[model samples]
Target: MHADTFGTFDDTLASGPRRTPLHALHLRRGARMVPFSGYDMPLHYPAGLLKEHLHTRAGAGLFDVSHMGQIALHADDPADAARALEALIPADILGLRSGRQRYGLLTDAAGGIRDDLMVARFGDRLVLVSYTTLRAPETGADL
Candidate 1:
């Protein structure tokens, strides 16, 4: 897979967009590269958006999501971590079991949404998938 095949770069921009780990691979597979979330990702493969969406709905599809931010919380006990996260997001984090995933919303003091994220419990740690495009919580104290 050659990076050159990943689509033409936007020379008009001040700087080139960041490439993901699968940039070359996507190009080799005839993917159409597009700038998204500060990364050059595949907008759709040769299969096109409709077929790709249908394929994902019908079975499964692989996507390169290296642009999203990942936050890991560690604690002595899984329950403690879950509880700590529950203070920040309006979701049943304490009720989430190992290997379970849930959608959560991070809200401000005024009850406005700061962002949406995905929370998953795995062993004694909690993994959070935060969208880079949305504002995030300032600190643990803010929760």
Candidate 2:
């Protein structure tokens, strides 16, 4: 598998890398650690990459994605939040039904994609999930 599929890394943090909630459990399972998106994440376990991949394909696997970003958008009307979000990303936010989720992208002025994100429509709000690395300033600035 490609390394990018594992996760992206950002090594520019001044306070060193942060740890996920499963950090200790990963260590206990003999996982090899790597820096990913400002967080210390597991690269592989004692079973190794290939074995883990095979096992996952054959049965099941659980991933720790707590390092990803989650943002909740709330407005007086849920449609208002949807309309606001549609101004930034290329998605049919207004058309999305409640309890539904849609994949979308954040693009720059020149139409270059900045990041991939998921927008979920709840009863009273829209919840966005994005990559931790690029969600800080750019996405925050736009919203």
> What pairs collide in candidate 2?
none
RMSD of 2: 7.4
Q: C-alpha displacement of 77 in model 2, angstroms?
A: 2.0
Report the alpha-carbon TM-score of model 1 versus the true structure: 0.76
Report the error of model 2 at residue 140, Å: 1.6
Question: What TM-score do all the candidates reach, one by one?
Answer: 0.76, 0.70
lDDT of 2 by residue, 1-143 (tens): 00112223344554888888799999999999998867889999998899999999999998887777666675667777777778778889899887888889878878888787777777765455454464655555465
Off by over 4 Å in 1: 1-14, 133-143
Angstrom error of the Cα, residue 53, model 2: value is 3.5
Residue 141's lDDT in candidate 1: 23
Clashes of 1: 0
RMSD of every candidate to native, in Å, equals: 8.4, 7.4
